[model samples]
Target: MGEIKYKRILLKLSGEALMGKQNFGIDGDVVKFIASEVKEAYEMGVQIGIVVGGGNIFRGVSESAKGMDRVSADYMGMLATVINSLALQNALENLGVPTRVQTAIEMRQVAEPFIRRRAIRHLEKGRVVIFGAGTGNPYFTTDTAATLRASEINADVVLKATKVDGVYDADPVKYKDAVKFDAITYLEVLNKGLKVMDSTAISMCMDNEIPIIVFDLFGKGNLKNILLGKKIGTLVEGKHD
Candidate 1:
C-alpha cells in the first residue's frame, strides 16, 4: 500500500453509525468494527481526532417542541453526544488506542472539559481526542462542531463518515441513478444545495480551506482507504477564484 497522504485528520461520525441495524442505542459489534478501523488508520501513522453526533440518543430539534424550549432541547442533544463519546472512548481504549473525551460542557467527573491547548497536546502525543457536546451551544449541529474543531486542531483533512459512499447529485438511496462526484468544489456544493453537510459547516470548512472527504463508514476498509489517500470517496475542496 502507498503511504498515507495526510498526517493528521479529523473524523466526523454520526451517532447513528454506532447503532448498526438496531432500532436505537449503541451496538457493541458495530462499535467494535468502527474501533478496529480507527486502529487500522492509527497503525498507518495517522493522527486522528473524532467528533461524534448525538442523533441516535436524541434529536432535540426534530422531536416535538410543543412544550419544550428550543434551547433546552438542543442542550439535551449535546448531552446525548457525551453519552456517545464515552461509549466510543471505551471501544477505542479496548483496542489499545489511547483516547480522550473532551466535552464543551464541564463534566470533569465523566470527561475533561474542552481545552484547545490540551486537545492539541493530546493529539501531539498520539492520543485520539473525541470532542463531544456540540460546540456547547444550542441550534448548532455537530457538523458545525466538527468544522470548528477541525480548524482549531489544524487537521490536514476532515473525513466525514456517512451512510453513503460519497456525495451524489441527489440522494443515492432514494434516487438510484444519482451521480457521485469523485471530487467537487465547495462552491458547487453550496450552489447545488447538496446535503453532504449543513451549510454552516461547509462555509466554515471553505473559509479555512480544509478539504473534506465524504465516504461510507459502513463499507469494509472505507476509512482505512481514505486515510491511505485512495480514490474511494467524494472530496470537497475550497473553490479557486
Candidate 2:
C-alpha cells in the first residue's frame, strides 16, 4: 500500500451511495464493492470509523415528515440508518474484515450501543467500527454525527463520500462552467454557504480543527486514492489553499 496520509479516518457515506443504480433500498452489488474498497483501506493499517446516512431508506427531513411530529420522523430516520449500517457490517464481515456496528440508540439485539472507549478499542484491534442512528437525537443529520464521532475518536480527518467529485462553486451538474476548489477553509465553506456539508457538521469540524475530504464515492478507487494521499477530492481544512 502507498503511504497513508492519515493514521485514522472517519468515512461518511450517504445512504444514497449504497443505493447504486436502484431507485431505493440497498443494492447488494454496490455494498460488496464498497466493502472491498473498505477492506483495502483496512489493510493499509489506517483505523477506520464509518457513519452512513439513511436518506435512501428514509429521510427524516423529507416531505414524508410533513404533518408528522418532527421527533417521531427523525427517530424513524435513525432506524433507517441502523438498517444501512447492518447491511454494511454484513458486507465487510463477508470479506473477512472484522467489523462492529454501534448505534446511538440501544439496539441490544442487533448492535452495541455507541461507546467511545469501546469504539477506539475496536479500531486498535484492527476492526472497522460503523456508527449508526445519527447521534441518538432528532433534528441532527448524519453528517453531524460523523463529525462528532470523528472528534471523539480523534480521527485525522473526515472523508465525506458524495456523488460529486469535489466541492464546486456551483452545481457542476447544472452549470458547465462551475469551478471546483482544490482546497478550502471551513469559514469559506460556511460564509459562501457551500453545501459540501450542513452548517452544524462543518462548524463542529471547524471548531475541532479537523480536516474534511469531500470526494466522489461512485468513482472507482476514489476512496483508496484519497487514503493514499492522492489529490482525488477537495480538501477542507482550517486554512485555504
Candidate 3:
C-alpha cells in the first residue's frame, strides 16, 4: 500500500525457523505461515528469492557431524536444504503464489539446476525463486550462498530472518540491558564478532555493497513492512544505512 523501498529481496530462512516449536524437521503449519507472509510481499509485486538453511535437519558443522567426513556431512546438509526448499515451494504453490525451486546440486527429477539467467527470468516473470543446496559444494555455509545468489540476482537487499528482532550488544534473551543498534557497518559486525551472519557472508555483502537487514520475521508483516520502507530491523551495510 505504501512505497516499496526494496523491489527485489533475498530472504535467508534458517531451517530451524521452519521447524516451529519443535526441535527439528519442517512443520507444515509454520511453512504455511511463512508462505502466507511471503505471499503478501509477492502480491505487492515484489520479486522474492530465498536461501534456506539445513540446520534443523542437519548442520555439517554441528556436533552430530563431528565424526563424519566433512565433505560428506556438508553434502548431506545441502540435501537437507533441498528438502526445506521443496517444502517451501509446496507451501507457496498451495497458496496460489507461483514459485520455483532451483538447487545447486543437479537433481532434475526434483528441481532445476541453478542457472543465473534462468533465475533472473523467473524473478522477472513474477515468480518466487527458492535457491537450495548451498552453492552445491562443501565448506561453504548457506549464508554465503545467500549473499552469492543475491549478488548474482542483483537483489536490492538481503533480508536475514532470525529469531531476534535485531543486533544487540549481548544476547537480548540473556541480558535484559543489552543495547540494540538500528544501523551498523559490516566491519563492526565482524570486529565485534556479532552473529548477524557468518563472516564469509558478511564479507561478500560488504564487497558487493549489498545491505543486510537482520530482523525477527516472526512478527506479523515484518517482511512486508521492510519492503514498504518501515525501519524495524538492524541494517548492516558497508557504511551508514
Candidate 4:
C-alpha cells in the first residue's frame, strides 16, 4: 500500500449521500458502494471512524422543522442518524468488515453508547467505528460530533465526504465561475465564510489541530484515493494558503 497521509481518520458522510437517486431515506446501492470504499481503506491498515448525518431522513433545523420546538426537532434528527448508522453498519458487516455502531443517545438494544476509550479500542482492533446521534444534544450538527470524536480519538484528519469535489469560493452549481481551492487554512475558511463545514465544527477542528479533506463521496475510488495520500480534494489545515 502507498503511504497514507493519515494512519487513522474520521469520515463524515451526510445522510443525503446515502440517498443516491432516491428522494428520501437510505439507498441500498449507495450504502453498498460506501461500504466497499471504506473496506478498501480498512484493508490498507487505516483505522476508520465514521460520522453520518440524518438530513436525508429528516433535517431537524430545516424548513420541515417549522412549528416544532427546536429541541424536539433536533432529537428527531438524532434518531434519524441512528437509523443511518445501523444501515451503514449492516452494509460493512455484509462485506466482511468488522464494524461497530455507537450512538451518543443511549439505545443499548441497537448500539453501544458512545465511549471514547471503547471507540479507540475498536479502531485498534481493526474495526470500523460508526458514530451516530450528534453529541446526544440538540442544536448541534453531526459535523460538530464528527470533529469532537476526531479530537477524542486523536485522528490524524477528518475526511468530509460531500457531493462537491472540494471547497469552492461560491456554490459551484449556482455560479459557473466558482473558484476551487487546492488547499486552504482554517482561519481563511472562517474569514471568507467558506461553507466547508459549520463554524463550530471548523473551530473545534482548528483548536484540536486536526486537518480536514473535503471531497466528492460519490466519485468512484475517491475515498480510497484520499486515504492513499492522493490530492483528490481540498485540504484545510492550520497553515498555508
Candidate 5:
C-alpha cells in the first residue's frame, strides 16, 4: 500500500447519498456501493468512523416537517439517522467488514449508546464504528455531530462525502463558471460563508485542528485515493499555500 496520509478518519455521509434515484429512504444499491468503497479503505488499514445524516429519511427543518413541534420533529429526525446507520451497518457486515453502530440516543435494543472509550477501542481492534442519531439534541445538524465525534476520537481528519467533487465558489450545477479550490483555510470558509459544512461544524473542526476534505463520494476509488494522498478533493485546514 502507498503511504497513508491519515491513519484515522471520520467520514461524514449525507443521507441523500443513500437515496440514489429514489424519492426518499435508503436505496439498497447505493448503500452497497458505499459499503464497497468503505470496505476498500478498511482493507488499507485506515481506522474509520462514520456520521450519517437523516435528510433522506426526514428533515426537521424541511417543508415536510412544517407545523410540527420543533423538538418533536428533531427527535423524529434523529430516529431517521439510526435507521440509516443500521442499513449501512448491514451492508458493511455483509461484505465481511466488522462494523458497529453507536447512537447518540440511548436505544440499547438497536445499538450501543455513544461512548468515547469504547468507540476508540473498536477502532483499535480493527472494527469500523458508525455514529448515528446526531448529537441527541434538537436543532443541531448532523454535520456538527460529525465534527464533535471526530474531536472526541482525536481523528486525523474529517472526510465529508458529498455529491460534489469539492468546494466551489458557487453551486457548480447551477453556475457554469464556478471555480474550485485545491485548498482553503477554515477562516476563509467562514468569512466567505462557503457551504462546505454548517458554521458550527466548521468551527468545531477549526478549534480541534482537524482538517476537512470535501470530496465526491460517488466517485469510485476516490476514498482510497485520498488515503494515498493523491489530493482528490478540496482540503480545508488551518492554513493554506
Candidate 6:
C-alpha cells in the first residue's frame, strides 16, 4: 500500500505470456488473472496503458513471409495484435475494470482508433487504454510500439512484464549461470546486447528518458511492488551512474 511512484505507466505484455502453459493462443484463466492484477493497480489510481504482442496467434515475419512481401506479413502481425487487444479488453471488462482498445489500424466497429489525445483523456478518466497494431507500420515489433506509445502518452515508466524477473547477461533459460542485473543503464544494455528488448525499443526509451522496469508478471504482487517504488526488478534508464 505504498504511494505509487508513477502516475501513469505503459505496460508491455508479450503474447506468449498470455498463453501461460498453453502451446498457443490465450489461456482464459491466465488472462483473467492478469486482468485481476491490472484491476488492483487501477483501483489504486494509477493510469495504465498496455501494448501487447501477437506471437501467440501469429508471427508474420516468421510464418507468412516465405514468398510474400515482408511489409504485408508485418501488417498481418499488427492485425493479430488487435485481436489480442480485443480479447484483453473483454477480459478486463468482465473483471469490472473500464477498458479501451485502440488500434493503429482503425476498426471503428470494434474499437477506437489510436488517438494520442483521446487516449490521454481516457487515462485521465481512469480507464485502461490498450494499444494494439504495433505502431500501424511494418517492421516494427510490439516492443517498439510500447516504447513509442509510452513516450506519446507521457508515461512515467514502461513496465515490461516478462517470464524472467530481470535482464540477464545471457539467456537464463539456457545459461544456468547467467547473471541477473538488479539495475542497469541503457548504455550497458546496448553495449552488452542483452535481449531484454529489441534494440529499437531500448533506444527509443533511452532517447525519451523513459525508464523501463523488467519483471516477471507471473510472480504475485510484482507489478504492485514495482508501482509502489519497491526494488523488485531490473531498472534500465538513461545515463545511469
State each model's CA lDDT, in order: 0.91, 0.94, 0.96, 0.95, 0.96, 0.92
Task: Give the per-residue lDDT digits (tens) of candidate 2, residues 128-174.
Answer: 99999999999899999999999999999999998899999999999
Q: Which ranges in model 3 have alpha carbons more than 4 Å from their true place?
A: none
**Residues 1-241, candidate 1, lDDT per residue (tens digit)?**
7878889899999999989888789999999999999999888878889999988888877655447898999999899999999999999999999999999999999999999999999988989999999999998999999999999999999999998899999998899999999999998999999998899999999999999999999888988888777888899997432
Clashing residue pairs, candidate 4? none
lDDT tens readout by residue for model 4, 166-233: 99999999998999999999999999999999999999999999999999998999988898789988
Sort order, lDDT high to low: 5, 3, 4, 2, 6, 1
Collision count of model 6: 0
lDDT of 6 by residue, 159-182 (tens): 999999899999999999999998
TM-score, model 6 to reference = 0.97
What's the TM-score of every candidate structure?
0.96, 0.98, 0.98, 0.98, 0.99, 0.97
| Candidate 4 wrong stretches, greater than 4 Å | none
> Which ten residues in a row are the worst by lDDT in model 2?
218-227
Cα lDDT tens digits for candidate 5, 1-241: 7899999999999999999989999999999999999999999999999999999999999999999999999999999999999999999999999999999999999999999999999999999999999999999999999999999999999999999999999999999899999999999999999999999999999999999999999999999999999988899999998
What clash pairs does model 2 have? none
